[model samples]
Target: MKQTPNVIVIEDNDDDFEALKFAFEEDGAPGLDIERCTTGPEAEHALDRLRDRAEISREDRVLIILDLRLPGLSGFDLLKTMRHDSRLRRIPVVILSSSSNQSDAIESYTAGANAYIRKPRNFDEYVDMVGSFRTFWTGCAELPVLG
Candidate 1:
């Protein structure tokens, strides 16, 4: 079996997604694979594919970095549905949105977001945060990986 912790970025911003992908690659975080899905439905379908391939398991550390404002199924809706799903409820979900509203932050945590991060306005700050994320998730955290 071959597995590593996986991160799924669920945001519609193509530019943001590409930037993040590049940043992660630049950070040289090995043993981690990054995946992207532009929409909630697309993410769901991708998750299904992963499951079919036996890539995601009950012990997999599948982190979801989501944007609150989406075109169709909003991040809130996706969070709610994921929480209700038995198979995916345990996966860590982090809200990474540009919204600065307190209510959005409150609702995200209340609705079971593991972490709520405001999208950084500065480019350097954004990269720094992603780098910090890599450090924490890959270094400090004892994430699940396949044998």
Candidate 2:
């Protein structure tokens, strides 16, 4: 497992993104490097850059929190692209969506998402969720060493 992986958040909603940022700060997420991407293209570019640099610098281990809906390309589409790209395929992608649809969850898993997490209804729950995620992903779990 890698020491600490960078986190890439692909979300379009301003409020949700703010809440996630606050949660990260409040929970004292350890060793987390966050990169925000509001659009699919932006995320793709970010991923490309990350992959390129990782290949050269041996910096691997990336986690992506993606929303289902977006202005341009959808999160599912991005997931597919990542899965198809060998440089990006191993990065853990967790779908953080407001939709609790079974089909959506199935589709995300089918598209090669590492996990599917439904967005909490309120800020408190969001904070709790963040805490749990940090505790597990950052503190306990042995993340993949993409390098």
Candidate 3:
């Protein structure tokens, strides 16, 4: 059986998280195992635990959606740390932030982000964005096996 894709969303805003959840549901991809981390440190600890898992299947896939403006450590700091870590480096990290600065996007890619997406302004846009994200990341992209 194909395992459900695991998605770790590191976002500090509750409203954005709720909107994302609603969008995923609207996209009809309820099979995704989505987890939320309110701060960068929380996500870092969670990723560390996931990386330390004893056994992982070849089909296991994990994705991280990070926000640039976070409470502790900052998203850029976390991205830099993840790139340096052998195990975490394999997991794909996407930046989903409200920032529209060109410098932020450039920095995100330079720091090791797989993709950088700006947050949608409306609920309909959110749904469309989530749908596209689901179709690409889960259906089309070949995710790295995680342990």
Candidate 4:
């Protein structure tokens, strides 16, 4: 059976989170289990919670959509932590940020981010981006099982 993937969105801005959520819903993503974390610390806590879940196995799917700039810990720090932890390193991290800087993208990629995507300026663009995201992550990509 195909396991449903859990999407962990690490975005601090309320409006941006809502916009992304709306885009996901509009994109016809079924069985979309989303977890929103306002800060990097909150996201770390959430991921740790999932890690401790007895029902969660290594075969379970998980995808982390992270923002570069956060209130508490920066995205780079979080990514580094995840990469070092054996239990979390397998999970693919996708960087979604408003920053369009080459350094940010290069740094994200260098830090083991699977993908770096810039946040869209408008709702239409966001919808399209989300659509592509859904298609790639859910439809095309083979995700690692969360244990």
lDDT of 3 by residue, 34-93 (tens): 999999789888887777751555566889999999998799999999899887888889
Residue 4 error, candidate 4, Å:
3.2
lDDT of 2 by residue, 1-147 (tens): 437778899999999999998999888876688889999889889878977866776646778899999878899999999999887787889999999789999999999998899998888998999999877776687777666
Candidate 1 structure quality by residue, lDDT tens digits, 1-147? 333478889989987887777777777767777788888788778667655544444555677789987876789988888787666676778899888999999999999998899987766777898899877766767654321
Colliding residue pairs in candidate 1 = none
lDDT (CA) per prediction:
0.78, 0.87, 0.88, 0.88
Checking candidate 2 for backbone clashes, the offending pairs are none
State how far residue 59 of model 2 sits from its true place (Å): 3.7
Q: TM-score for all predictions?
A: 0.85, 0.93, 0.94, 0.93
lDDT of 2 at 17: 96
lDDT, candidate 4, 1-147, per-residue tens: 445589999999998999999999998788999989999789889878866752456566889999988999999999998888788888899999999899999999999999999999999999999998888888888887765
Candidate 2 to truth, TM:
0.93
- Two-way lDDT contest, 1 vs 4, winner: 4
Lowest-sum lDDT 10-residue window in model 2: 53-62
